[model samples]
Target: MTASLSYAHGTSATPLLGETIGDNLRRTVEAHGDREALVVRSQGYRATWRELWQATTDVARGLIASGVKRGDRVGVWSPNRHEWVVLQYAAARAGAILVNINPAYRTTELDYALRKCGVGVLFLARGFRQANYVAMLAEVRPNLPDLRLALTFEDDWAALLDAGRGVDEAVLAERERSLQFDDPVNIQYTSGTTGFPKGATLSHHNILNNGYFTGEALGYGPDDRVCIPVPFYHCFGMVLGNLACTTHGATMVIPGEAFDPIAVLETVQAERCTSLYGVPTMFIAELDHPRFAEFDVSSLRTGIMAGSPCPVEIMRRVISQMHMREVTIVYGMTETSPGSTQSARTDSIERRVSTVGRVEPHVEVKVVDPATGAVVPRGTSGELCTRGYSVMLGYWDDEAATKAAIDAAGWMHTGDLATMDAESYVNIVGRIKDTIIRGGENISPREVEEFLHTHPAVSEAQVIGVPSEKYGEEVMAWIRVRAGATVTPEELTSFCAGKIATYKIPRHWKLVDEFPMTVTGKVQKYRMRELSTAELGLGKAAQIKMA
Candidate 1:
């Protein structure tokens, strides 16, 4: 839908749809000057709104001085540091599109993303662990034809700030003159599993409005301190972790490096963090840590969990042991500003645990049969389609792919298979491309996979839930053994005995050498399915004698 189209679903009380993100930030800064805006715990840095406004202005001036113009692309390739937040605001202030490049990217991956986005300036960390970002940039320099400036976080930050001296008024006026609410603010690339990554162009309004809605949904306020361990490169970090807190005048605690459960605990205790945002794997790791019981995490109130389905046991621990007010399960992709459906705090435990919850305010969702392109009846599985203000402005320079995803009615057809229950809560069953049709019964691999993960010995599991000639498709399990542990195929089968149906049980099991993964670490089930089908001939059928 066009930016002027107001009503999407629950967006009735939202502010004017046409306002720009920078304008909103400017207003927030003006209103909450003395309030602390960000807390960089690693650097021992805290900035009030007034200080953050000035720093953002200074960095915007520095970017302009470095030849970054309006509509140009600037890449921020760093971990969860103050600079990452500064660069985002600075780029927004200058009307430059910020390209989020994951800090975990290596030379090859970085080259691909930088070249694809045609980035003009890169703000990078000098070095972290084995990643020498400066050295990697030097390697990519030859191929990055549009790249003009390399600003390192360590040695060049002071010099860049110095260059902005005596230019605040000029830069602020320029920012006001050039900024527009509809301008593209960020180009977030999706982790491509099937093909090359697509850069989803998010408008200034798209992200800002989403942040505001998220804050409202979670009941955030000025007194709340949010712990943000998710990387800023991801939408979870940018929209929910950073912008959500900033919009509400809340304090954000950034740890600056990879997540350590102990470090996270310490930060939460030290900062008195009241909320947290993380993926399922992150929480699983934190709960599984040996010293988890020693930490006092009583301060946390609420948070959002995504990336995968959270188990019921883990949810219990989060509420019983950690004492979090609520753990909301959110589902979306890079295309929809990364939030479409969210579990409300008041939802029943069955709804919260079994479904991903209802569509967010101002978002319209439908389940349509992929082949027929017709809306399905409630509770019938189909491709989940979404249309909303947060829907992205198409993939960068990939019109064909964009057209394939978004239709003429503005509905973006998410590749996920799902169903809406009587309460309108959406339950994601599986990826449309990953469905397993065994014996004419369409099976969701996620269901079987989640059930199998409950097994104690199974640290990680993937169910290619692939095609069989006799049954049409068969369930195959590829498992990763826990360290210094062993489980045979029969034992794993027995583990699923009472938990899942007989057909859902994997007919064949293989201990994988290593899982093929995407850049963001999601297991590539398509590849695993291919390997399974190739290794175990699916065409053959076994004759069984019925008792």
Candidate 2:
């Protein structure tokens, strides 16, 4: 018989959960009511499961009184905060779809996202780093007709809770009872390296089950304390960090508002955290800290290193030095409720260090030819696709795009290049698409290209990801300037400073007459990356392996 096609399945004796986010929270609270549920050192706040449940219900009732209705889009634009966590469960409890807006977003990106989703109420932090959320929202809120209210965390959190006291508790209970497992509860804006971002509409069943399964892979329990330094805006924080801990009755420890190596080290030691979460760069930063030896991280036994692949060298050090012998790696996108595969704690060291591990429970994975759509044999590279309850309902309000991404058969095409061994171990080889993952943040080239085109000095612009040792990949732009338009790279930088995200701005710039193209005139981004890598003396950086 011919070798079987590349396909795999994840079996589970436990069935998928059929409960809403609120339902799951109530169940966990009933079981671990006295357990520590949340900790935010920046806010100097901590809460038990019962306290968290009370806070979430209060916020949910407040949202209802503030004119938020079921199916409404509620946006939260802030860094990792205790309010952000409360809003997450509260919005779900009130039957509102929570929209996670990136904290790094500027006026243009912010306005586009809020308007695109028709967000009714926005909760925001005033400022972080150089970006001013208060001013940016002020500049854009008038244009956002759907945005009836914008509440600042510094001034409004307490008032929102007080407003809930006026509403009847029965009303909040009714709203929670109306929510179902399949109801769309969260809209995560995913830029997948193309154009403006798309809101990946995920249901309660999609993320809750994913979080539960991920925690199970780590062998979590109520005693496990998870240190999460990743930002809450992404699935890495909300799903894998918070949701994962909540599902298993574990404590969620926030290192700080933003990721600081010292804060992570300090939090782990002080909190006696058993688990930690971050991208590979974060692990590198923590390990390479000048005072690394001073902190005792012996409490850590398990965690996850995701966003990008983890190098073997880094994995070795993490297991030995960080005392994370059960460290795991997860593989998925925002559309798959953010996790379709994860490494198990029992995986062999070689497999744990090298692969993305096996398919997730209640999920299926297959590698197939990009053109033929036929399953490829084992050890053959092909596009990776997943199918299961974890897939999103679809991209919010983008039916055509959704159809293109998820096939009629329900397989979510990942557009990622991968290979499977006979043992069904999945190894991510590369991407079929172009995306610049700078220090774990996914940057879209088209979004930056469109913004640069608005510049009068620029006739055309193209962006590519160049190899970087620091960020794994940094953005590079090649521009065809309009004739007689004398614009320097510094001028372009200044123009983009307050308009777009700082990381999305091109780190390398080149003035080009024209781009290399194929016979059909498709601009070849690979050629641009190659030429830019050679010209910028980045060969040494390119040679440094991250996986």
Candidate 3:
């Protein structure tokens, strides 16, 4: 029998939606006029589809009145709130490119995004937690000649909307009519692990259809209420959570401004939310909260656990304890509208936990030899690549980087190493660039990390390659022990004895309160390497090579 190659494409009878975001929102409102559309617990806001349309249109008009034009960039820097949602649709309706500014960014990062994108108008919250956005903007304003205006959600938000009263609806309608489905509508910065961040530019068609299909994969409907605790700046929240809910006419429930375990549990119980969204760590926090049993989460039937590969044990616990029998694992990056594959509601627990499912609707995914770009045979590990309508137009204003990422055939070369089963399920092994070469043997840190997760005292684990004089590279683990649990490195290494290969076992260990991560919850392994090398005085070892 011929072995299956690592290539799969998704097909469905349902045609892709060609309309723009505004057009889709109008159709949804027409169908579910009186149905609940949005519920913001932090702001005590609730709106039906009709009311949401009105508010969205008002904000769209507000953008036009503020002199935003087609192709102009408008930046939104805030946490998850009603205003952020309003601005997202508003920018789409006004034909402006919505630039998502990470709320956690300081002056340097914020300044770079604003100037790079040439943002004409900026919408921001006064402050989020400890970062005072207003002060940071003030510090960076002088260098941003392209920033025509700045509007704060605290005081200027109302006035900005009121400014629309003077603008006619016809003007907004004309702008919306001019928008093509392929027109760029959003720009999101990828996590700059190695260098400065690059903006991933997405179109109306790129995101809207992806969102619709994501909801379809989850079996979402008008009756489903989705609790979204993830940050809107990431595609997981905006495209998957908000856009998914809106495209399906489902109600969007915001637990809080930021992720709060207590708030998530309370909101889920109070709203009887049918679905929930979070990364694996977020779910872990909710499951391990001291008051975990206080709230009833019986309504949760499905959701997504992604951003990183979820431990199999945690997946089982979430399914059994959280009542999320249909919860799936999604896999992708910001460049691919953030999801190339997702498990189905009917998939077996093993399939859902072990793989990221098959290719998503209208998307083609393949694992190829990293150097040769040839499709790999089943069970052979290679770099995963995806091509589809969902792929971003390119990195914003950086054609060189864009060309380097998306090849001539239009496949986005994801630097993730993965394997495909004969059944077509893809298992992400680790990052191709993250593979550790110890004593000339290849080791996947994810493999060791997953094994560490099985340890009773280990709550979280991040394994990285540290420089070694003799071996050239050695495995080091950073662990977060379970609260009230005592563990030492000696105990952990002893547990690994006779269980796994000697080289795969971590040679050094450090206990950490938390792993260094991006705002979107992705671990920074490069940072870990730098810190570990410096702390361990491995400078000379880093320069050595295996003889």
The TM-scores of all predictions, comma-separated, are 0.91, 0.82, 0.98
Query: How much is the lDDT of residue 273 in candidate 3?
Result: 97
Off by over 4 Å in 2: 1-3, 434-547
Tell me the number of clashing residue pairs for each predicted model. 5, 0, 0
Query: Which 10 consecutive residues of model 1 have the lowest summed lDDT?
Result: 1-10
lDDT per residue, candidate 2, 338-404, as tens digits? 9988888889889987689989999999999988899999998788999999999999899999999
Q: CA lDDT, every prediction? A: 0.80, 0.87, 0.92
Question: Candidate 2 has which clashing residue pairs, if any?
Answer: none
Tens digits of per-residue lDDT for model 1, 469-493: 6676779888876556789999999
lDDT comparing candidate 3 with the true structure? 0.92
Tens digits of lDDT, candidate 3, 1-547:
2457888889889899999999999999999999999999989999999999999899888889999999999999999999999889989999999999998899989999999989989999999999999999999999999998999988898898899988999998888888899999999999867677999999999999989999999999999999999999999999999999999999999998999899999999999999999888888889888899998999999999989889888899889999999998889899999899999989999999889999999999999998788998999999999999999999999999999999999999999999999888999998876888898899989899889999999988889999988888999999999888999999999999998899999999999988887766777888999999999988833543212
Question: What lDDT is obtained when candidate 2 is compared to the true structure?
Answer: 0.87
Best by lDDT: 3
- What is the lDDT, from 0 to 100, of the residue 58 in candidate 2? 92
How do these models rank on lDDT, best leading?
3, 2, 1
The TM-score leader among the candidates is: 3
Off by over 4 Å in 1: 1-8, 16-18, 166-168, 456-460, 465-473, 478-487, 510-521, 527-547
lDDT at 334, model 1: 85
